[model samples]
Target: MDDQNKNLILATVLSFLVVMVWFWLFPPEEPELTDLPPVAEAADVTTPSVAAETTSTPTTTPAASETVAEAARIAIETPEFKGSLSLQGARIDDLSLTQYREELADGSPIVHLLKPVGEAEAYFATFGWASAEGIAADQVPGPDTIWSVESGDALTPETPVTLVWDNGAGHIFRTEISVDEDFMFDYVQSVENTGTSNITLRPYGLLRRHGTPADLKNFFILHEGLVRMTDGELEETDYKKIVDYDLDPREGTQAVRLEATENGWIGYTDHYWMTTLIPEQGTAFRSTSKYFDSRDLYQAEAVMALQTVAPGETTEVTTRLYAGAKEWDAIRNYENEEGVTGFLDSIDWGWFFFLTKPIFWLLHNLNVIIGNMGWSIIALTFILKALVLPLAYKSYVSMAKMKELQPEMEALKEKSGEDKQALQQGMMKLYKDNKVNPAAGCMPILLQIPIFFSLYKVIFVTIELRHAPWIGWIKDLSAPDPSSIINLFGLLPWSAPEPGSFIALIAIGIMPIVLGVSMWLQQKLNPAPTDPTQKMIFAYMPWVFMFMLGGFASGLVLYWITNNVITFIQQYTIMRSHGSKPDLFGNITSSFKKAPPAKDAPAKPKNK
Candidate 1:
């Protein structure tokens, strides 16, 4: 193979291998079948007997049924969220985000963040006290215990609600639930020991989901299960992992527990939403994630240190619940301002977090300034191109010099004849004499691979890109192009095949076609290879890339198209400056014409 063909093949193979390895390492996760035991009612499990230290066997606790006809509920209303808190367990369930929806189209339902218990696929958060010595199990308030409203008529950002329950023994339990304008909910639980000598109890917060969400994307790029930040370390566990864990006899479930002394939070994170328990800062707590086989329930808990309340003394504990869409700014604020350690990491930044984070930050700020995510992506591509221009200029200059030396190189090959070593040495000497680096041509391609992967990660994983729109039929930048060549871009009555399907791979969309065209135009700056194998590989590479990236997020495809166009402009300009004016038009026209064969070395076969 010729030198150009060899370098081309090497670059193509390396790029393809990197992409394949990335997908193999982080392939789409398949939903595993779980044989969950039947769900037991709250009445079926025996309440733990009161102990001196409040250390009771951690058994499966059924959530209070929302379907109960007479169960009272406290209404929750915020600028960004709306839901009802079940009075039976005071669980912050039945929540929905006002800012987002199930679909981008009008009339689509708001994104429901939590569902009440007893509903299929029920998910919710609950807070209560675990019983201690001198405190009956019933006195601590079980999941099914009803409480009466003591203060507010309705719960809102400005008005908080207080619920009160009495244990007949003169121990009064009061829960004051407060909400901010956003998703955070403050639950302050206090106990007044009027008749008891002393009582010890542990305040615990639990978030439970009965089954996997029906709309889980299951894509490896996004995490849609358990996420926690413990003492400056972040952990993410999938539902399958929690379900497959070995049964813990003490918890009577499959669970993982961590002890955090400084700051921590635990919750279930969906693609764009999350429900987490944020313990008070500087408080030591036991963070536990459990999957109960009996109820098919996945639960995360923050059980705070035990507290003792003496007679006529009131003891209180405060915890926070976050339930809403995972807005980038909101989560970052909570991390920086509210002291939720590593809260921003709750968004699955993946292994390329360093690149993805900064890239997304720039893209996000640009979007804010431009007021359009698609334009923001285009702007980001331009900024990145400018940043790498110096390196790209050097590389392109080297390639132009190489092109200028083509005739000399051909002459050297002829002089050296079949001596491969002499030919290589000659080429190296020529390169050194010209102060050119043959390897310099590979730098741009190598740098782009990681940047492309990082951008893909950001577009796929960040909620900010979800449902972001560009012009004309491109409503969701995070998703593949909806218009497909198979359907003639909606001209035909049929729809395109589903993304990731074999058919969709071949029946790519307009963006990928444009991507291929941009790459093809870029290739036209140089002449097609003379060797047949080299010609064939170069001919198919652009379209191969087109099909390969056809199913990627539109935002990423947009970036690729933009990059190709900018690179073409930069290369053409630089090559012209180097006095090696690329015959782009001539090369493109010549590509359609048959090439004349090389001139023979004057009649060598006339000996006869």
Candidate 2:
């Protein structure tokens, strides 16, 4: 009996323990989560290939000048001011690719990479306030800024992009640009190995800004900073803004010096979803040097080779750039482009290109019909709840039957006395005969968990929810609840904590209360256990849960509350159909209409 009791207690405890851990893992992952995401350290041992990469410096040119000159006559032509432009065989004059200013929030600048024939005296350089951030490209008129590649072999501007190799055939690279129905342009660039020898090319998509080497190398600049390191898998960091993150001296097997005389910073940003930039701080500017560790994502070694490529062979690589803000309509349209959507890595959108993405598409479609994130969330939740209603119904039936049999169960327990096995066996027989399944309630709740997590993921990481507004004090459902008491003098305002978002602060506070109340109500529907100690320990579950989720997102808490309320309604409906009072813990006597036991049957025993 003691062993049986111990086993039952252990099972119950283990169930709760496993769920608690699972719940812990469900919340959004960001720098501020209660627990930091685990970081894996690089192994102490080094590989020969990694050693070779560390020692080998791939051929590099002095980075292109950020300054473009107005020396060309067409430089005076006014650039049409609007959203974005599409070009095909259009002659670009005094072309430049750079940020409008040193700030990340500055509007993305317009870039022109092609030019008309005879436009450059070699090249024209300059800058302008492309986005009104008090920054512009400029011309470096001195000899120091220009580089004339002396091709031992003759080459022309119409050279259909060729690869020149020593022992192997070289590689041919091509750059192409396309626009969608919404006029969002995607620049797809590919470098293919056309060489006879196989080669491993260290591919880096580079953008150069015109500024003094001092400014370029020392001052922290650009956007898309921070590399999100995943478990065991490698993803490159967003951007690196070190004063001298670039290699020097052309090519060799040595680490190149990339620092400027003055303090400056550089950046490496890919599209909008991921970026790594270093901020300027103190004498040391913001630097994300760790993001460029090539070994982290691909091969653990760094070698840019156009290795032995068999004749007529090609290795192509392409990347997409999302050059705008989090405008949902624009973004969704942009995502439709082939091979362009993968850049939206901010959301762990499923890789199938179909499964995970449909969630967003469905949400967006519903938005056109409903027009608000709050309403959208509510609608989505209700629909999901409806889909799972059968499970809840099953659980309700189980609960109702269990309530009906409580008295008989208690009577059996007393008759069995200290013989717990006999009591359990008898109870099992009764349950089997009556078609009652104890695990029904548990199974339904467990099934709901994954959906709950998926929704939570959608709410937290989807850029569509960035500043989405809800009703009243719940301005941004994605951030936090803004509903709070306006105590201006308080240390932490219900809405904010000084430097934090007011909406996020309030939302965090409300979650626990909402989740706790629902849990309490659900637990209350079940009778107090016959064991005094068991009842005592379980009584505090509500308050404990309330405290546990105090910092969770208000949206997640809202989902929990809605789920419980729906379950309660379903349970009540099921009970009333059987003519029993669902509010009452058990209707054992009422269900049987107080019938007396037969002579051959054992008499009911008294309670402990």
Candidate 3:
């Protein structure tokens, strides 16, 4: 075989091998309920501060379900959020993201980010003082302690609400909670000591979840669990990892802690939304991830440094809570403008952060300019192809140079047919003499691998693509193309096969069909291989990929189609520029020509 065929075959086989192993190599996410580590008598949420006890535990405060009656609630209304606050612990529970819905269906309920204790998958954030230095446990409010509403009737951007708890021992605790038009909430925690003696206390903010989130996608591509940033470093701890945490000798519990001297936040992040505790930046704080193995609960804590309050003196600390959709622009603004360190990285950029970040940046800006994510993706394909044009030009030029040497290579092959080593030597000398690099043609195909994965990560993980639409039949660019050939794309009276089933694999949609066609058309740029094995492989490759990726997100399939088309155009134009115009029509026509019958073997074959 010529070096061109060898290179092309090697690239194709490598791609095929990668696709074949994709299923088992990168395992799908295990079900949340089934994958628990062995458990001990788990502890409740612990105070991340020193010598301070929780009302529920080795420290004190209830993070699990309780028989306690529902506490009085204050309505929280923001343009992007609508929920309630529980006065019991001044907890921001019962919150829903007004901007997002439970499903794409009409009239679906708004996405609930936090729920009260009684609800399934209960999650919320609470802040309180951890009593220390001679301050009794009762000297500070616990989770069960009810607070008096001291100010606004509702929590809104224009009107902040205040909740007051009196230790009645001459120390008063007040929380003034305010919200922005979007998702951030500010809490001003103030302590005033009226007694003659001073007191030591640490104010802590925590996010607690009861059991695993039932809606966990559990996909390995996305991170949906405990995500935290300490100083400038980021860490993600999944539920299973949290469950397996060893007992901490420092906190004397099943937990992990890291100190952030300057900037940090701790939180639980789901597929699209997040609920995190943001301590004041540029301050020392302890970030902890704790799991109650027995209770099947998880908690993230941001405990501030211990402070002493003198008699008649007041100490106030301001912290923030981010509880809503992880919109890229909004989060980026927090990182760049609001000084949330590495905040934008909160989005799961995967291992390809270098590529995913910039790809998302371009896609985001393109969407902003075009107002349609589908078109933006198509436009992104154009820009990407343009960026790689120089490399692609050299690759195609090398391919054309190889095509120019095909006649010489064939003559050498016939002359050295009985001497395989001589044929190989002749091919190498011919390539070197012509200054043609046989391997150059494979570079673009190899480069496409990483770009493909990075784009897939961005499309699958970013909120910007969620429910984004293009033209008809392309609603929800993040989802598979709903049109199915099995039902004649709804022109038939029956519905299409259910997605992810074997039938759906065979019943691919319009986008995947176009993808296969684009690949086939690109392949037709070169004549069909004369070798039977090579011809069979090239013939089947495109349709095989079509079926394989039929179930992928429409946006990804759209990208693949666009990429293939642009590649075909670039190869054709570059080949023409090199004075080696591809005989595209002749190639397509020749592919349809029936193969000639082989000569009959002699009787010796039958004897064997």
- Per-model TM values vs. the true structure: 0.89, 0.54, 0.90
**lDDT winner among the candidates?**
3
Per-residue lDDT of 126 in model 1: 80
lDDT of each residue in 1-608, candidate 1, tens digit only: 24764677557765785876477356666655553333434633333322544244743345544435358788888899777888877877788888898987799999887876556677778888887667766678756678889999889999999999998997999999999887789999898999848888788888878878877777766777889988888888887788898876656667788889888899999888889999998989888888767667777888888888899999999999988888889889988998888888988888989999899899989999999999999999999999999888888887777665555566666767888777777777777667778778777887897899899888888889999999898999988888899999999999889777778878989999999999988877643453456668887878878877888889999999999999999988887776665776552111121212123312112112
| Residues 541-593, model 3: lDDT tens digits | 89888877888899999999999999998888777766665665552111121
Tens digits of per-residue lDDT, candidate 2, 1-608, equal 12244346537655765766465455323332132121111211111121132332222222222222211121211121122111211112233333222222336444333222222211111110000111111211111122221121211112211121121224443333333333122323333544454443322222222211111111111123322212212233322333224532332211222322222222232222221111111222111132123312111111121222344665433322222233445544433543222234433442332433665667777778999877776676677778777767777777666666666666766777888678777777766766777656555556675666666666655656655666655555655443333443233634344324434334345545667777777766554455556666667767665644444455666666777777666777776665556554433233434334323227655334
- The CA lDDT of each predicted structure is 0.79, 0.40, 0.79
Model 2 residue runs over 4 Å out of place are: 1-57, 63-204, 207-272, 275-320, 324-346, 350-361, 484-511, 527-534, 584-608
Better of 1 and 2 by TM-score: 1
Question: Which parts of model 3 have CA positions greater than 4 angstroms off?
Answer: 1-44, 52-57, 62-68, 526-532, 585-608
lDDT of 2: 0.40
- Which pairs, if any, clash in model 3? 53-59, 54-59, 54-60, 55-60, 55-61, 56-60, 56-61, 57-60
